[model samples]
Target: MNPSSTLSLLRGICAAALLATATSGGPAAAESWPTVPDELFAALGLERDVPANVLYDAVAARFHDQDQGYGKGKFADLWEPIAISRYFDPGLYEGRDNLDFEVQAGECASCHESVTPGWVHSWDNSVHADLDAIRALPEDDSRAYKKEHLAEVEANLRSMGLLAEGQPLATVGCADCHLGVNVKAGNHKTDLRLPDAAACGQCHVRQFSERESERDTITWPQDQWPAGRPSHALSLQANYETAIWAGMTQREVAEGCTMCHTTQATCNQCHTRHEFSAAQARKPEVCSNCHNGVDHNEFENYMLSRHGIIYQANGDKWDWDKPLSEAFASAGYNAPTCQTCHMGLHGQPTHNLVQKVRWGFAPMRSIADNLDHPFFAERRELWVATCSQCHSPSFANAWLDSMDKGTEQGLRVVEQGNAELKAMYDEGILIGQVTNRPAPPKPDEDAPGGFFGLFWTEGNNPTAIEYRNAQMWEQQLMRQFKGLAHANPGGFTYTHGWSELIGSVAIIRDEATRLREFRELQAKVRELENAADR
Candidate 1:
């Protein structure tokens, strides 16, 4: 009812839940989840093994306020998908046993050891399976830090009722992620499918959060939210492709491409989970799926590059599945894979693939942002050092420098389109503009004015002239940046990227002039009509 009473109840209920089911065996707070700690459940008089629907009802009744987690976005946003999953089929968990997944997950190896022997063996040797090795490292080591923090992970599971009482720690199992939240009623189904990225995100909080941030910016210039089904574009942090793909073109499935996995920020886009084999992700093919089109044709360019040439000849001999170490790659790796340059397999390897790509968006000042960026230079050098594993420093620096120059040249074109738009606004042709955020969820029809819409900027009541002009820059300039970023400088210059930018800028300027003339004629018509009436 009151603030003090609600806080007191929340406190008391949490204490009871913890006292009733809590164990000292799980990992500590450092590696814990942003999930509801013991207090929320205990305060509500709900058991850890409560049904999904029942839990949802309680959460709806009690957690009415949108809490801004203990940290910033961690707990608040982290809880979003988990809370949203409450409506998942409760019948799926019908009448299941009190099996502990920590032990049960281990048994998955036995069945797989015979049936899917390769998967089991590969997983056995994976870093995920080697928890003991992780535990033995220094506390400061990230793996060691993760090992020491099982208690929080366990608490998160317990709160969700996914991990029941008497279940041991280390709950990595087939069902934990693969299966949706299980009610206590049914046998575990073997035919279950892949976990949604949102579910995987519950545990892998950081990656998912970055994806959410990236997802925020991933959309085509549109006038509406959830743009009607068959909404053909994936949110790739750019709008031009979306405009081109959805706005300009029609599906040619015979062309052998479709927007299949664009719905949510899929983590498995690269990882290809179940096994989540690192070696598989380290190859070039994983990226070719989405990166090969007109926008960023790195895969096709790599096939032509010295790196791709070598891999084509010798890749089959190189061990595709190897541990990530200083000398993991063979001498046969004379050229780079997508992973070789972006991932830096020759030196320090990391999952943060876009670290070197400091600015994903366009108009990188008069120069590339990476040029003067203190943080960016270190990361870029690290990549070049990896390149130096095969290429000499002079060779690597020269190639990279060319890419930087190409990007600057591309930016000049973007500046032109931008300048054109600015001039239009100056002439009072456009009512206003929207450059920063995506256009507001489609304005009500009764609402006034065209919206100035682009991936980068926004404006209201954007006439056809305004819309087409912005589309020109979004498609053209963005292609230039992406092409260079992908090692296809040609794509950035003559063929697709630069040529397109130049063409689009001309189109934008011409259209803006035509629209102004049309508007002026309309004004004259209105003035003449008034005089005739007089």
Candidate 2:
């Protein structure tokens, strides 16, 4: 068939699907889901009578807007996990239903198995495809719980009207995510959707809820940054909100920020797609993709730490398939991995990564600044308990104290640099402050744009001193505090942390002295010119 013929055929099919959806709304045509629990709808501040499809669409639209109607829709400012705003293509499922889902798996696989064999192979090995095999396991088998979980998921979907009556529970396949409720109206070309976190939440409800809980987690000041910021929950938003990312006309360079910040779009970064292997995600290497760099060298610091050293040497021997809760006792783990520390909370492993986070991964503020605040104090105790799993309570407490001190130390250096630069800018001696230097890009009109100026330069406006100041706070200070947090002493002292900070400070001091002398020379020149005129 020619391209024109194929297009005609797809249009015909889509028209028929829309007619069916519109005309067939009564009891026989449209199926009603079991009544969902009241608390669930109550949480979203919705009446129970609202259809599942309506709620789903509204949630997607929230991300499309400037301010999510958090308090308007719900009594409290509850967060609905969002898709990557740029990737939210509503046209994919504009007018569709899942009536054709029965044939979706076969149709998707028939072509993809040949065109993308690796994807097929990976999915074949994943538990998503082996539902029957998991169900067949003996009652007492170690993996039997997975079968129970699947059943629970099925029940949840059914209650929520996502799984229709008489629709057999099927393995999670391409169409389940991509075509979703729009399977009946979908074609290979225009109808496919990139599944977001909310789409995945349709099945893995608990995990989705946990990930979204980052929004509700305690935030200090309640106003400095958005709630649950500086975390995976708001990572993509942070990228979009960044002045440098928006200011750069070079889109390719700017979009690179999305490579790591896209956690809001899909969970595939950690749980890689096709296979979506939990084992792969459990490893520390998975984190290195985004967590390594000059500013946040978490991966590098962890590698040098004693914990990382043990994982590198003996991790292969350890069982990667087991849950992290079993790491110390049953998984042959002699030391902590990235997941072991960050994901563990309240005595169990969880999908929420920020529950126990105190200082976070950056040098936002030292824990010493708010040690007594309930939010930090409670989590601080949890940290001690987490560490005390391997070491004594006293040892954990002492080490955490040391980390706090290190954080304060790094913060002081950064503060000092900022103060010195601000002084120069105020006194009108800073190089290029008033002249050649252009104001930073929109949303950041501040002169001497510290961090924002790092991305752009014009007429040497963010002079040498400004550059050094941004580096000291943004890059070196981050490394120093993060290094201490990760337990990499060499990382903090030598590699790229405190040692680098000291160097930046020295440069700033030397530059300040020279600038002052240059100003003095200018004054003398002006005085000599006046004498000549007389």
Candidate 3:
């Protein structure tokens, strides 16, 4: 028989075995099953009296039907039957009411299967599953830390108001964030639920809230900071607050998840179809939606970098889908994708590179622990191997060293600038008397646009003007950084370099202030000489 036929035959045998176990009054009888222990039940927010065997039988039956006697077919199709069965039958597990859990879990899984199937599989492999076959082998210190940290994270979630007041953390499963309800005409309108901004915010509150506070006074950084200009500092702050905060429904905050998770093109926006590979997730383009602007120009930076240039120029000649080989020559350009630097390939018989590397773009320090194991100590060695994909080992090393040095120098400049600013502020050099402080007459009021007539206007201050200019300059500098990092020429020149020039303009304004004072002093001296002559 062919491999497919052989697989189908094996599945048939397994199905028969499952059926025999379920029906017979043998040792596998469901009635004699062990019940879920009170402790475990309590932890899962389930009733202790629940019978584990009944749930197991239901799950086994569903599994058998879905597999069709271990039939050779598409894995997704096979999973569908199991998903449907599990959704309809709550008795697939012990400890709790099957109906309630299944309803929520089913809805979440069904929607995600349509939108992000790969993520659904990834989540299944995640720590969420409770199957004995999938359990990690417990070592002494490792098990202890896992338990402690899990508790810590759960506590953190509760404190952040992501969970209900008395809800157990285990019960805070997939639905807490991903599910949405729509009420219209005093009846349910649509029950379409997908992971949205509010869902991500439940866990990533700090990231979501960082740009919302104290907008008016908070100055943009000098590297990307504005000098003498009018303040529009509150623009981003206002938008985020109004859209994410004041908006009443899930649709209101829909932009949040899409802003970071997708791009302007293609089905791969969430995850690629077919294999739904993990490799695609590590690419920078996935984050282009939100990071395309002046400050966080990850897309621009990656595109302009040597790696991006090489890929763009030569990708057609190489098999991008296959695992990268050491001897593989680049068609023309010399660099790898964002994945090359971060997620190492599987075929290369070296240490796991993804584990050891710390790409600290986001402030979150949470990382998968498998990377730190002793067996993966050669992660740095693997990272070096990535550089060798394009340039010689020596050249790659030197380039990285130079980049590091440049970063250090840039940081130093920022520190020095900040120190000077602090000194000036502390000495009260910024305060001054102005010649005019009059309240200007109001303009003739126009009719309200629609219903709301929200309107206001005010004259600008010199300091405020300078600050706004500095803000624009700051934005430009950030754009330049993105361009340089991504290897995108346009971003490097227009966005990144242009921002630097604007920043220079702001600096000139500061210098001009001192020059103006000097000119006034010279004019006074000339007048005094003329008076003496008279």
Candidate 4:
């Protein structure tokens, strides 16, 4: 037979089988569709009146029978185990309904054999297979209970939204993320999968909600985007810990696990292709997609630092593959990636999904100060162990101290400059008519311009002119300090130090104008008095 004819026959057979199964609702149907418990069904917005047996029968037949005609053969196989594990798991069904038992016993093994044959054997080795058995132990039991307790420790994930009424604990499962309610069928269907953001938000509601809230407040300069795209890392939450420490409230961190793990875009946004790989996650460039910005320019800083310079000059002479260890010397490596100091000398347990890492980018007032708690106590030992890979204990301690002293000195200088400006302003040596005494002036004619200067003269008021000049000096000092701390020459000049210096000069100019106005007013008053006396 021709290839086209053969393909046509297969389609017809599949379609006919699906129609028969949907209408007939046979034994296969009964066993294929595991009925959700009343509470679960109600939570999912299914009909409570429909008998569990009937629903089971319909779903089973629709899914399993060859004649029922869903064209997704391999796709169905990939989907079934995840669906079963997510929805019909033993714990979720315990008090709700025993209907799943009948369906699971009679049809599950056989149907799964057809759908995902390899998974039948693999399921025995899976973490999910024994989760319920572990959860059944007494709370004090160390062996089994410890695992359960650890899983529930909450990771302090941020919340995004309230749980739908009757929805299970916001834990993840294959079907929960991928499937949707079949409104027409009044049962779950594999159609219309949730968007990645929404799927992740089901558990990570706090982080998701926080990101939305911060979106407007955290803005990027228009020049940052050469092509008119939004600035990198402008949203803040793109870097998980930075976002939280920067300003996110404690309330935003109380949600479940999904919030920070997922992003507005799909996983592939950073990981590239859909088949996520460990190798891709390990690269520094992957993080640069969002982190190459003014606040957290890890990529740019790393490149300019000694670590990045060496990596650029040398190829793969050092071991990039191994976790940082005593054998992994920086002498040979020359330079390091961001993974060196923050992650580890050679990328240790810092970024492990299963375990938290202690070392982090220390939060700062101006990216120069050290955070109060540099080591998250929960993972402190783990981080110290990673440091042991390169430096001796004394060396590491000394290095940290040096870094702290350097940062503090820079900040002190800036603070001193600010104090000087405040003192100058207080003395009133420089004076001005402060049109807008407390706030910057509005860009309107309410304070009239040259065209209507005489008519609007009354609105202008002489205020503390020297004080404004001091304020400008304080701003410049802040920029200089921030640049010195980060060791970024460009950041110090353009973004921090120089920009503030210019602003201070502008304030001085404004103060000078105010002083001139005061003198002019005094002269005019004297002239008027002399005329009256004459």
- Measured by lDDT, the strongest candidate is 2
Model 1: per-residue lDDT, tens digit, 313-420?
Answer: 988876654433322332245566777666442264433344454444444462254366554576568667876877799987887777777777877876787687
Clashes of 4: 29
Tens-place lDDT per residue, model 2, 1-534, is 998677646744754454344323322111122222233344456554554344444334443344642211221122222333344322113323543333444577777789889988988898888677876876434454465456556644665676675454657777788777425435644456667777776666556655655655636553445566667766766766666666665656555676788786578779887798878899999999999998898999999999999999999999887667668866789998889888887667767787777776555554457767787788889988888778899999999889888888878877776777777788888877667667776656665437776777778767877888888888898888888888999878887777887888788778778888999999999999999999
The candidate maximizing TM-score is 2
Residue 426 lDDT, candidate 1, scale 0-100:
68
Kindly state the number of residue pairs that clash in model 3. 37
TM-score for each of the candidates: 0.52, 0.81, 0.38, 0.37
The global Cα lDDT (0 to 1) of model 2 is 0.68
- Candidate 4 residues 321-350, lDDT tens each? 332321243224444454444443224322
Q: By lDDT, highest first, what's the ranking?
A: 2, 1, 3, 4
Model 1 regions more than 4 Å off? 1-173, 176-267, 292-297, 324-331, 366-370, 430-468, 518-534
- Model 3 Cα shift for residue 280 (angstroms): 6.9
| Preferred candidate (lDDT higher): 1 or 4 | 1
RMSD (CA, angstroms), candidate 3: 18.5
Task: Write the number of the candidate with greater lDDT, choosing between 2 and 3.
Answer: 2
Instruction: List runs of model 4 lying over 4 Å from the truth.
Output: 1-277, 315-334, 344-347, 352-388, 392-395, 416-534
lDDT of 3 by residue, 368-449 (tens): 2232443333543554566676568887557544433333333333334334433433433332313322222222221111
